[model samples]
Target chain A: MNILIIGAAGMIGSKLTNRLIADGNLGGKAIDKVILVDVVEPTAPADAPFATETMAADLSSPGVAATLVEKRADVIFHLAAIVSGEAEADFEKGYRINLDGTRFLFDAIQAADGYVPRVVFTSSIAVFGAPFPDAIPDEFHHTPLTSYGTQKAIGELILSDYTRRGFMDGIGIRLPTICVRPGKPNKAASGFFSSIIREPLAGQEVVLPVSEDVRHWHASPRSAINFLIHAATIDGEKVGTRRNLTMPGLSVTVGEQIEALRRVAGDNVVARIRREPDPVIMKIVEGWPRNFAPVRAPALGFRSETDFEQIIRAHIEDELGGTFVA
Target chain B: MNILIIGAAGMIGSKLTNRLIADGNLGGKAIDKVILVDVVEPTAPADAPFATETMAADLSSPGVAATLVEKRADVIFHLAAIVSGEAEADFEKGYRINLDGTRFLFDAIQAADGYVPRVVFTSSIAVFGAPFPDAIPDEFHHTPLTSYGTQKAIGELILSDYTRRGFMDGIGIRLPTICVRPGKPNKAASGFFSSIIREPLAGQEVVLPVSEDVRHWHASPRSAINFLIHAATIDGEKVGTRRNLTMPGLSVTVGEQIEALRRVAGDNVVARIRREPDPVIMKIVEGWPRNFAPVRAPALGFRSETDFEQIIRAHIEDELGGTFVA
Candidate 1:
């Protein structure tokens, strides 16, 4: 089966691509060819045996999605999207790429004629807004507080509609914040979660935007990749008409995360974190949902990292070669 | 204050226009002028007090909304949309008119310098899908089962974003299905609710699509107009950042509606209703939400007709001079 991974250069996208190549197949379906498309060319696996093609192009452009899906991929992992900060900052760019780009891809698939690839779309927990109960239930309404969340919510609706129309087999997996995300700090409002741990572990100081009590939902990068794989292989019968599923994740406060980091690393590592409260970031964080019940995803076989420790360990293993430099 | 009403020729649109004209002001602010727009020329009021102009053009067209809003209307009532049945039958048309038309209006409003029109967008209860509990709360996520619902849901998101960015002061009022809609039969899936009562009272035969057990949310056309008016005039402070509010309505079953019809027009009129179970229609009906718990809208002073009987009476009073020809 031929496979395609859009936004293959991003964290989750790159990880999932490597896993797919490492396994050489998805749930026994042998991948003969893999197409990796992103805004920037993704680094190819050094020992990849499969026929891998890396293409750099803006997917939002007309005919780009159709051109990418021309060979009729058996599976398409659509993990590409502008992050929360960028989306919030550049509204037109965000909608063009996130909303219009997703729609274009769905339309492209429909136009492909009888080629209904298993589309595993990566949505975010940002889809849920605040004033939520302690743990947001699976059946909660999507009242996104941010433009990014709204875009993802809209994308979910479109995916469901296109799937219902039998244009394609689509599944939207709403992922939690990936904790201890490997690589340098980024512009995401949630970036502090990782920066506190990642930067501190490298003996660098990182600012804490909000209070330690500020809580959020989280999963490791590995769990996110696992979710995509599971979404790709899951029986479409079980999902029924509802194509979007909120994946399971650990709900922990910033204090808990800091404590976990202290336990994993040491008091010295924890001391590298600086407390700097910003009211703007606090207001945004306060409006965000802290956790989700995600009953459906687990019942449907999707899983998350066991604990924050496992999340940290996965980051160390994947990014630091099982060792964290002090 | 200059006010603009899109879809001014439609049932709710025309009534809202007349109501605004009669009231002469909204929420204590006096109206200075009114711009009525529709696909066809609107029926001008016989004796107009305020300056009123009717322009016939498709709002979905490029530059139409910008041209309409060029003078900078103080308030914009975007009530135009393709009905559910039409939208479902023609997906492209649905997205084109509902989605594109809304975006154009929002963009037009934003483009006008020093123009911050209070946009009262008419959304529908169709935004909520089935598997609904006995009463859907304000927090219920939008899981629109039909293309029409999807379009409305998307529109709500866009309205919220545009509002958040201070592009325009917008509010999305998700109206319940208008019962006893005073008019000839139209192509809407929910039209049967009104047709069963309206046609029978006019001494015409009407078919019941589903069983009496089929329950759904409803409000009279008067109530729908009331919602639009309230949404337009209500203080933005009361709404805060949550721009969309589910308008209150009565949760009535098909049996209750028929019972109300019988009570109002006697069994002779009810006898004119024929039972014809349509699985296709039933399936569509099944996916619709039966009730909503619109706590916010009411707190902010939006009101709906108390009962189905009153709703029927309202139809008679407003449309037929409180007398039936039968």
Candidate 2:
């Protein structure tokens, strides 16, 4: 009935908030209240069908997580994290926010009396490193090459353990890179994957840092939201002890992505993606997961766009209001 | 070269200390000093060839890790952890000792300027849970079923990350169940596995909690010490970024272990094991790993006993002065 969305100011979190309000209910239950919290106060929607409260707080700070959960929301979506590049740059800050913050939230829930809410954690495909199989299997070991990936993997482990101990019903979804992300490009190493698509569609030239043959896994913002919702409502018992899962997505090379863009919005839009090699970005991208053969998340009813063309089209439909610059 | 051994009061730690003392050198360098630390003061060996310091300290305590690394030991063997049964019973204490203590030690190393010690971390097979393939592969995912397993898995992740970041030259060895552990019976769930072989040879009755058909992985204590020493001195560059490795071990069933005991110590000793089922222990043991195809450790010069009979004989020769009650 009640929901709490941490990191509700971020891209997927903001979109998910709008979608949940639009739907007016979750899992056949009418929404009673929605509380949005982020480091920066999230803009609350006007005249929503349900009660709304917005606040700014850092979950890593002492006593913040404990105070926030006093409302006893039926579901919690934890999406707050420093981006991969920033985490690598600031080691102490990364561990503080990503690792300690997540643990604080989980421990807070455990310390609470008779409260077992469904928790949806946003993990990443970064949990898997390079030198992958053709498609990384569900049983593939986590050997994260970056600090951000390591922190996320730790979060997944803690989530599973806490769930197994019956402290909370938690599901960690290892999201694929969200392609065609709607917003200005940020400093995330994976930002170029989305910006190359988003910026070009908006009639702006964007630099393609890596080579054309470089492959990566991707889903759209809409699909990522779908994953979070599904994870929140999924049956914990059926999911078993392995609560963390790699969400499905389209695996395509940069060249394939360009072709998909060409097919969706013509060669004019595709041509806007200029080639400019940045070796720093290239080296960082080298260690990322290219693809995954995730068996568990798909079986648990999580879905994503089938192809890169579908992903580009979803961005146009949802963020571009049924039209691109073309 | 100086060496620091944490948890030096424990079975493997003490044995490893004695072995190091006996050799008087590591990697062809003569031993300059040896520091042994634990929760309680470890018994110092009389007339050691090198300088030895034995002290009581809890690594999880504030400032303890920082102070311990002040000497900047060339090789640090971090073997400190609460046993599985105790960790399961006291969750907070388990996490404090196993997880936070390890992180503290690592972070302390990172904080020390120009001090990058070779760290040998003792992990466990508990990192891998049940529902395993016939032989768990090198890339098998960690899905620990207990609090202790969860803590150990976290340690392995941190070790690999720290090593990758260049803060320390670290190697984590996921040890198999130490068969024929030389000590009085303790409360660990896995204690029975050792007790069955240990107590029978001493003319004492020991309970066989699990069914004879239950198979598990094992290695002798001598092999464990050898793995530690090898890990401490091995080439870090050759180990690469995947610093944590599952040590190779023999896989055998309880029935097979009993047969090995009969062959090694005769029927009188084998008859000393009483058939008394423990539902709790059985449930706990059911989630442990039975076999592994550990490709990396063996290739990197890590080894263990080849057969269960060899494990029993190791106990007899090492702990029983080359004779048993039989």
Which candidate leads in lDDT?
2
Error of 1 at B299 (Å): 0.9
TM-score for the first chain of model 1? 0.96
Top model number, TM-score: 2
* Cα lDDT, all candidates: 0.87, 0.91
Global Cα RMSD, each model: 1.9, 1.3
lDDT tens digits, residue span A170-210, model 2: 99999998888888988787888999889989999999999
Q: What is the CA-based DockQ of model 1?
A: 0.72
Cα deviation of A179, candidate 2, in Å: 0.4
TM-score of predicted structure 1: 0.96
Interface RMSDs of all predictions?
1.1, 0.6
Q: How would you encode candidate 1's per-residue C-alpha lDDT over B223-303 as one tens digit per residue?
A: 998888888888898798778899999998899999998888898899999999988889877878888888898999999
How would you encode candidate 2's per-residue C-alpha lDDT over B22-135 as one tens digit per residue? 899998899999999999999999967999999899999989999999989999999999988788889899999999999999999999998999999999888887799999
